[model samples]
Target: MVPVAPTVLFLINEHIATEALLGEAFTDHGFDVETFEVVPAERAEDPAGHVTFPDPAGYDVIAPLGATWPVYEPALRDTWVGDEMQLMRDAAAGGTALLGVCFGGQLLAQTFGGSVARSPRPEIGWCEVTSDRSDIVPGGPWFQWHFDRWSLPPGATELARTADSSQAFVLGRALALQFHPEVDTELLKVWLAADSNGEALQAGITHDELLTRTEELAVDTAARVRRLVAGFLTYLAGQPRPS
Candidate 1:
């Protein structure tokens, strides 16, 4: 049978800048990607009101980007009501790939029987991740921007880590990343300027610091991200289903 084009769904909660950066990454990979920006009724509350689940049959992959976890998590859970956990459960079970970045990563874990809660320290600026599973993730420092962290769900493989938190997890064809490997210098500037992260800049973290670090990050990280995407695609390709 001829393979169908892989269709990917993107669930975005942050404003245009973040989603645009990530979308560019997806487009670069040659996947057919569709996106939705779930606007929360309250930035700090549940996003249940804005929750949306399009026909899963149409997409081979699903990606949820970073946002206020409080808002996105409830919405995703409430979208399924009694079977909230099954959102990811069913996806993984059916061989559909899921990639969650930062807040989205937390949601993926929470939906898959893991815990997502506030970290002891908020890792807001550029940082690094240690990779015990270097075959799956590149070692050394990776970028981070989260106040929360996740414990791996049962049967999940942890592909990346840092002193601060668990960085990445893989269950079947699905993967979740705590750090922002998708980020670049331009995106970094826009994110720093955004209201959601303005406090970090005002607290003496200058744009220059971020730009310099992200540039250093891009040097090695682009290859890592490409490898990760290819790895995930390989997993999806090996799935029982034909896509």
Candidate 2:
């Protein structure tokens, strides 16, 4: 009998970015991919009124991707962040692997007894990180676009970091990251096009410069993502899920 391949559920919060290269990495790892947009485009500002999520334990891996909104904003916390945290907690309790990115990492941090707040300085464009666990998270010129940062959660081992904040951590079977390893030139174009708030420009990174950097690092970043996903599945997924 043919075995059922493992599956992944990638939550696309606020439509800030799609799975892009992340989805491709999962597919290459032999997992079926499901990208779900938890926040509706029309109601992104008010996602509290109507949002529903499936059982996180239903998939082998669940990724809460990056987002435009902060997880700690009072309005967001009241409407959806609180509920999503609960779901992630439940998923952790039930042996489902989690991979959190940026805002998603912030969510995991809060769910696991850490906190999120404004960063001293925004990290935009491509920057190199320092990773202790080079086997899992490579020190990279990874894409980063965030104004907030996460404190390392309890019982989490920080695998990577920059001067500003924790770049990557592992809480049981979950891996949380502050950088965007999924970004490629095409995906970055989408993110840059949606620069309604001039976030990148304000951070001192021009669109052209970031795009150029992204294109230059495309091959290496893609290889890094594949290695990351492979390392996560081979090593972390074998352990018990986060509680």
Candidate 3:
């Protein structure tokens, strides 16, 4: 008999981004990965009530990726924000593991009774974190590009943090991460180039400098992502899957 591969859904959101290294890492770890976008392109500027997210059934993992929107905005909360949060809650209740990245992490925190707010100091480019579980979250510079941070949800364990905010947390099978473990030079190029109003410049990082650093760190970053996924899978192994 042949072993069947586990499936994962990568919620790419409305942004022009990919799972990049993160989705690839999961594939290397033997999981079938699928991509979904919650906000339709026509409604990118105002996604509220424009989309209905897919029901997460049969997938072993549901990973909500980064986005350009803030999770705390009241306008969003009334529409797709509430909708997606409900989806996350439903997936969690049904035993699908949740992995929320950046904005996704903030949303996960919000859904799980925590809060998301603008950080006193926003993080961009590659930033270092102090990890309580370094074997999983790691301590070295991980890619970050968000101005918001998540308050630890009830029953969630803090895995890593920085002075600005919580960097990573875990609750049951769910892993919420503030950093981008899947970022690579190409993806960063796509993102920075698409920043119409110069988001990186506003954050004090130049496009050339950031991409240069990414080139220097790409090798190590990929290794860290690989190890991070392995550690995460091992951690998930100990949790109960929905029957």
TM-score of each: 0.81, 0.96, 0.95
**Tens digits of per-residue lDDT for model 2, 119-174:** 99999988789999888898877889999999888799999988888899998889
TM-score of 1: 0.81
> Which residue pairs show collisions in model 3?
none
Model 3 Cα shift for residue 188 (angstroms) = 0.7
Per-residue lDDT of 42-133 in model 3, one digit per residue for the tens?
A: 77776767457887877888998888889877888888788889999999988888888998889899999999988887798888888988
Model 1: pairs clashing at backbone N, Cα or C within 3 Å: 128-141, 128-142, 129-142
lDDT of 1 at 88: 57
Error of 2 at 142 (Å): 0.7
Clashes of each: 3, 0, 0
**Residues 39-111 of candidate 1: C-alpha lDDT, one tens digit per residue:** 5435434444434456555678878777744423554556532242455566766667788888778878887
Better of 1 and 2 by lDDT: 2
Off by over 4 Å in 1: 1-3, 16-25, 40-50, 71-86, 195-198, 201-204, 236-238
TM-score of 3: 0.95
Candidate 1: lDDT of 90? 66
lDDT values of the candidates? 0.68, 0.87, 0.86
Alpha-carbon runs more than 4 Å astray in model 2: 240-243
